[model samples]
Target chain A: MVKAKIYVQLKASVLDPQGKAVTTSLHAIGYERVADTRISKYIEIIFDETDLAAVDTQVHSICDKLLANPNTEHYHFELETME
Target chain B: MRVSVITFPGSNCDQDALEVFETRGHTVHSIWHKDTDLQNPDLVILPGGFSYGDYLRCGALARFSPIVKEVVAHAQRGGYLWGICNGFQILTETGLLPGTLLMNNTLQFICQHQYIRIETANTPYTHGLRVGTALDIPIAHKEGNYFIDEPGLRELQDQDRIVFRYCDADGNIAPGTNPNGALDDIAGICNTTRNILGMMPHPERAATDSVSSNDGKQIFRALEDYFTTRA
Candidate 1:
């Protein structure tokens, strides 16, 4: 079995309003050193198969095709083998 | 004219769309998202409201609904397709329209009457509108901020595919008039073929005289005008 951890975030060029709001609140609470803040989605998927190469390809496809918008978001994934 | 409004699980505006179309003296059908076949209506509308409960982004999950395949095929055959609000998000998610709707610049759920200047009257939805006319419509969404790559936006402008721009009451498109900070103040756009249109405003909400503004009635009338020409 394999488990995949995916992170999806809007590209840097895209403005993140939620992140900016969080940053503003942080500053109000006295986190003055915080220059900026960004938010993203973290998704986890588990597969029953043990084929590492095939799992890698499938995970990438899932991220590219569904989890991320190529126009505004980027994604990365890490996989771990299950004992 | 015949219109079909697709209703996804969470779609709240399908009935509104149907009412407006029917009131305009057209046969309207309510199609479920899971249906793979359409009844060959003259126009298909993906109405507003959070589809799939806004899961995985506004329209991401709804884009893969079974009926979208048929909708795409219908568009490929030059059928008129209109998407409003969340429906517009679905269009972008499905790649039927370019750009993406991100969280509002204020990071808030905004629901209010807004103005949009008609950029072009070339599409069926805007056929009866004069260029530069400002229409008051209701807009309600948290992710209505539109974003597109620079080159793609330039190309869309070059092709005159941009249909509407958020504007002031006098039809000015300055930054203050942009409610959601959408790139280029874009509120509505059409595909290259001009048959598919997606917009964030709710024309159906403003189509009735009982409503404060009936400015949106023209959009439905424009469709009828477009159909008359074809007939």
Candidate 2:
């Protein structure tokens, strides 16, 4: 089995309101060194296929089609093969 | 005119849109999201709702609905398509419209009467309205902040695709008046062909005087006038 871990996040130029609120709370709790915070989504998918190259292509297509909005978000993935 | 309002699994405003069009003496139909046919609608509306329980993203999953193919085809043929609130998000998701709707800056679901100024009166949606005319409409959504890249924003501006902008009662556009912190205070926009419109405000909810203001009626009236003139 092959497992893929994907991380989706808003682009640097796009504003992240939830992340900003978290940063504010962190400061209030005495974490003054925290200058920025951004929230992102982590997704994991398992595939039965063993071909790494083919899986890579499918993962990229899935990310572009459903996992992320290209207009505001970007994503990257890492694949691990498990026997 | 024949109008069709699409009802997704969680859509709550489908009836409201139908009622508004019916009251205006137009034939209205409720189309299910799974249905592949638009039934030859003169105007198609994607109403506001939390389709697919808003899983993953606001309109991401809903875009994959079976009916979306027909909706896209309708727009490609220059048919009138209007999306309201959640519908606006779906339009952006389907790539039928530019830009995306992000979570509100306040991180809260804002529901209230919002004043939006007509940015351009050239489109069929705002045909009879004058620029800077303020219409009191209600907006209810958590992810209504519109975002577009720099070049896309420039294209929209240069092509006059921006249809409405959030503004004060006096028609002044400012940060304080922007309910969702949409870039440039944008409340609504249309496609380059000017046949498709996506807006966060719910004009149907304010279409009657008893609801608050009947300013929303002007939009329907303008659309009716456009069709009449064309006929």
| TM-score of every candidate relative to the true structure | 0.98, 0.98
Give me the runs in candidate 1 sitting further than 4 Å from their true place: none
Superpose all Cα atoms of candidate 2 onto the true structure and report the RMSD in Å to 1 decimal. Answer: 0.9
Model 1 residue A47 lDDT score: 98
What is the Cα-based lDDT of residue B75 in candidate 1?
Answer: 93
Give the whole-model CA lDDT for all candidates, comma-separated.
Answer: 0.93, 0.94
Q: State the lDDT at B164 in candidate 2.
A: 96
- Ten contiguous residues with the weakest lDDT in model 2 chain B: B208-217
lDDT of 1 by residue, A1-83 (tens): 99999999989999988899999999999999999999999999999989999999999899888999999999998999999
Given the true complex, what DockQ would model 2 score?
0.96
Identify the runs in model 2 with alpha carbons over 4 angstroms from their true place. Answer: none
